[model samples]
Target chain A: MTPTITAFETSPDRGQGLARDMRVRWSLEEVRQPYEVRLVSFAAMKEPAHLARHPFGQIPTYEEGELVLFESGAIVLHIAQRHAGLLPDDANARARAVAWMFAAVNTIEPPILDLQNAKFQEGDKPWAAERMPLVLDRIRQRAGQLSERLDDADWLDGAFSAGDLMMIGVLRRLRPSGLLDEYPNLAAYVARGEARPAFKRAFDAQLAVFTSRQPAAG
Target chain B: MTPTITAFETSPDRGQGLARDMRVRWSLEEVRQPYEVRLVSFAAMKEPAHLARHPFGQIPTYEEGELVLFESGAIVLHIAQRHAGLLPDDANARARAVAWMFAAVNTIEPPILDLQNAKFQEGDKPWAAERMPLVLDRIRQRAGQLSERLDDADWLDGAFSAGDLMMIGVLRRLRPSGLLDEYPNLAAYVARGEARPAFKRAFDAQLAVFTSRQPAAG
Candidate 1:
């Protein structure tokens, strides 16, 4: 069964592939699995139908027959588990890959998301300017450690598993912040992930949605 | 060989079980698995040893033979995958449970952490008072949706899985915030989790460490 995942009918990022559905799409592409997309309007996403599929009423929900899942990390892992390409055959390596997936979302992504909240959510707030540095510092702290660990490696772990996929997605969010450039290797790391054929395909797919829906210029 | 995990030498939460190690401990107790603990000081966590085990320098790094893993969610899922208690036997149900784990950490915990950052990390900022309500409201938004889904259900899913374990852990952080009271059902759900015997065992274990290390009052 071709799993159906949801994306924003009109992505706030304007199809930058930052919407989480891009993660699931990238994972599916890595595994060479075909899937379908169900574009959801913001209002419809909050409605009962989408909420039932995702309690938090967010997009990038995966539904295949009876199995419905959300959270890009989980959806990516599910795809990785079912298909061999995204994880290692060795049990220990596979478990480590899963650990990196958790670290990406839990430890790494939280601070990056805070940076976003400081800008998008609290940009007008009086503290945005003052707290922005603190938030950015938090991201810098994690990036420094991650860069030290990566140390010219091609991937976070031994191979390009789901861990790299999620980490790269989180790092992509930092592209606009310019902090990623401060850590040269980490910036290169994001570049390597972006260069993958699978990533390019997924990026184009989501970008097309935004482009095709562009309002005609006056 | 028994798996070894790490914890803070003296937890800042003062045995409140807010530390990530508590999650790993609870999972072990639920699965009846015996494990060893390695206490790392704040400085030691940054040293080469612990950093080798956990790149991010956090507690709750699991080591058994050659397989080392970090991230409480990943550790819990690893325990669940290897042991019988924490995941469902059905594949679809298991996938759903994993998704809930991600939601708890990714979706639910982020807002709660924002509240913490506002208080613990940025409490003295000039805009702290004004911006706290915004952070609090963000948490309430998620709590409202979660409460509706869990209206009458015992757990997020059908049975007690790692999903509930993680969600409960994230919610426990909110007890001091008092915002949990706004959602009565969600509060009760957290209470139900606390009342579990495994949770009690885990709590006591961490609390004992804090109690033993308490500095004598003058």
Candidate 2:
């Protein structure tokens, strides 16, 4: 069965592939799984039907037969577990790959998310200006540690597993902040991930959604 | 062979079971797995040895034979996968449980962690007092949504799984904030988790570490 995943009817990022649905789409492409996408509007996402699918009422929910899963990390892991090419065969390597997945979302992404909250959510607040440095510094600290660990490694660990997929996805969000450029290797790592054929296919698929919704150019 | 995990030489929370180690310990206890603890001081956690085990240099790192893992969510999931008690036998249920684990750390915990950063990290800043409500409200939004979904249910989903374990661990951090109390059901849900015998054992064990280090009364 071809799994169906939800994405924004109109992505806030305007098809920048920064919204989490990109992660699920990229993972499916990597695993060579041809799936369907269901675009949901902001209001519809909060409706009872969507809320039942995702308690948080967010997009990128995965539904296959009786299974319904949310959280891009979980959905991506689900795809990786059921298919090949996303995780390594060795048990230890697989476990490490998963560790990196959790690190990407739980460890690295939180600070990045904070940067967003500071900029968009609290940009008007009086404290936003002064607090911006603190938030950026936090991201710098994690990115620096990650850069040190990567230390010219192609991926986080032995092959380009789901860990790298998720880590690169998270790091891509930092491009606008310009902090990623500070770590040359980490920036290149994101570039490498984006260069993958699977990533390009997924990126184009989501971008098409936004492009199609735009009014025709005069 | 018994696996070894790391904890703080002196927990900042003083054994309130707030540190990530408690999650691993509680999961191990739930699975009836005997394990050893390796305590690391703040200084030691940043050293090369600990950094090797955990690139981010944080506790608790799980070392079982040849496999080493970090991220409490990953460690707990590892224990859940290897042991019988923590994950549901059904594959779909198991995936949902894993989703909850991600939700706990990613969705729920980020705001809670932000509250911490606002209070402790920038508590001395001039805008700390004014900026506090925004941080608290973010947590409340998630807590409210969670409470609505949980309703009167005993757990997030069917029978207690690693999902509940991780969600409960994350919610426990909100207790001091009082935001959790706004949703009485969520608060009681956490109480249900604490009432578990395994939770008690885990809590007591971590607490013992802190108490043992206290100065003797004259």
Screening candidate 2 with a backbone cut-off below 3 angstroms (N, C-alpha, C), the clashing residue pairs are none
Best by lDDT: 2
Candidate 2 DockQ category? high
Worst lDDT run of 10 residues, candidate 2 chain A, spans A8-17
TM-score for each candidate, following the candidate numbering: 0.98, 0.99
Q: For all the predictions, what are the DockQ values? A: 0.86, 0.90
lDDT, candidate 1, at A94: 90
True contacts kept of each: 0.85, 0.84
Give every collision pair in model 1: none
